[model samples]
Target chain A: MAYELQYYPGATSVAENRRKHMSGKVEKLRDISDEDLTLVLGHRAPGSDYPSTHPPLAEMGEPECSMRELVEPTPGAKAGDRIRYVQFADSMYNAPATPYFRSYNAAICFRGVDPGTLSGRQVVEARERDMEEVAKFQIETEMTCPALAGLRGATVHGHSLRLPEDGVMFDMLDRCRKEGDVIIMHKDQVGRPIDKKVNLGKPMSEEEAAKRTTIYRVDNVSFRDDPEVIEWVHRVFDQRTKYGFKPE
Target chain B: MVNSSDTNSSDTSFLQLEVSPSRLLKPETAQALLNEIVELEGIIRLFVHGPGLPQTVPYGPAKGEPVHHPANTLIEVGGQTMELAVYVGGIRLEVADADVKEQVREVCERVLPVPFEFREGHFIPTRQTVTDYAKRGPGADPVMIGMTDPKGKLKDHPVCILKSESKGND
Candidate 1:
């Protein structure tokens, strides 16, 4: 019989959202220009050549390794690209993609990706060009809420802070500001002011965010309310304990 | 002849109106609320506290540049001009009795557009503290005890005493 894979098991919306994100089934919501994405990332200039660390793999001539012959190299790896990183700070207040979920999505959806999940922020490091492609997916998909998630390389203190009167997450660096309805980024991720502002489209309404969020809060969809998830957690815990002590 | 000790004997209470998960109230709303609340009788001292708005960008590439927060500006309260440094998060009042507390609540309901709760407690230090003596030096004015910002230099007095001007327009 052909094997079928399951993402997550639960009937609740929060669990469903987790499954969708893990399976990369979320619909693309917005499109950010390559120039804007590069500017916000602050890694290199929009039109500048990606600085390579070594000669291209094609020119270098590969050593006799069976594993290297079996697996195909990524585009950046072929070009001997330098590894770069992009970090996102997701708000705890029902942001669509939390740190853990972001890492899960990257692990399942992309290859040659290194995802690190922190308490307030998540980082993905890959070859420069590859990282930009991943960042574009993250920014343009339902994975990010413009007001709730921030592209901050440092000073990621606003994840748990209360939203400002304007409803956007608090950012001491003031990298982004709301103009009428849309959020605009006026600075790079590292807080250096940029020459032009990148318009990030309108933020989702409270109702939409609540519906799309993967977080389980008592105020929203509580984790305890999902019996399937609770049972699965218990089963995993029991199996770990049972197998840890005595092996068959 | 009255004894000198009798002058110090009196009951006083403080009232605090705090906006939990502090929000930045508009400058106009803050001004209007202050004007109405300060006019009530039995309210002796009024102080507003919240997140400070620095005059300049403290760090990053924009260091030393002026921070243009709309809430951080000069406001007229009870005809007295005062500069607001912080977003109005809480208002502490030295009220004479419970009756004045009720009056303040009425004013809050009519003026404040955000959520707020009032509690009766000693919100400010009534007596001189050790820091006051250490920071202000000896012979510091008793009136400036809990009023001044400790982080601010001696020249920058944060305390403002509101006064009514007979000819001033509202």
Candidate 2:
């Protein structure tokens, strides 16, 4: 199975929103549901309750989960609600997942908080901070640590990973984090980071979402050495392929 | 632009921030919050208990100080392991001069408290108040902190570092 790490607002909504004024330019958008491995990040449906002066545009939503409640004005919090989640993007997690297990794909997630305003540059910077903050939460303590929980991909740059100059990349990100940059992923655009943008104006039923494409809600993650974890990724990949929409 | 790998030191420290709940800040009142913080700089001494924490923050009372409001936390001071950003601590700085507060408030997000005089700023600890109700945990400093460097100069309250022995082991 192929998996890619993505950033927020990168995921456009499968459901059309009236308030957003979207013109169907975005295609292959995935559903941010519990069932699908992919998720919708900062990009939200019209009428989403999130506050405007939100910390950083990148932080509104994305692969980060612990922050879901504090920042994201997600619809009612329930078991059925889709979370700010992501997908594996590629076969990186396939057999012999350990080597790949040491790292995660770095992605740049962004969103226009105002929707009416905010230049692309501002959105990019916000993502930088969000990524940094995520790193802090990871190394600082396990209480709200992303590492302690199911690992989530952060937006750190991964330019020279071992496979592609990997050692230097990981070191660089760790260095950035120490300097307080909060480098999460070791590289940039290593793999696909699933993105889901929701436009609230026009909502889609669960059936509509399920019918659109293949999704595998990441139920779990663990040490690649742990055979069960590796086996599970394979199972989820199978399920994703079973229900996932393959590109034509 | 220092990288983490360059550092040979293992000692790491984090900053602790406390927004006076007494202000009764609301998510909507971004401007008031910024104003209150700036104003507090003048009467900063009046607010601190040990006279150390409050003294660490810098007071910019110039009638015509250049406006300083960053949309994101920019690094104010950076060294091997030490860093100080006016907004690095996740506290948002609000200035009434440029209408920065108003623009930030339009969003539903909480505005972070901003800082000034970072490297030269005071050494603010993690916790401020102590109660008989709360349990003291490991890694917490226990002392009636004051503003004095090891040399006994009343140089600055917050920045003055006292040895662990000086603080007295409880």
RMSD of each: 5.3, 23.9
lDDT of 1 at B13: 39
TM-score of chain B of 1: 0.80
Q: Candidate 1 residues B1-170, lDDT tens each? A: 22323222133334434333244466687888888987887776667876666666666445665545556789998777989877665777667677888888888888877666777776656555566666756656444556666677767765665642321111
The stretch of ten residues in a row with the least summed lDDT in candidate 2 chain B is: B46-55
Where is model 1 more than 4 Å wrong at Cα? A236-248, B1-12, B21-36, B39-94, B117-133, B137-170
Best by lDDT: 1
In order of listing, the candidates' clash counts read 0, 62
TM-score of chain B of 2: 0.17
Residue pairs in clash, model 1: none
Q: Local error of candidate 2 at A152, Å?
A: 4.1
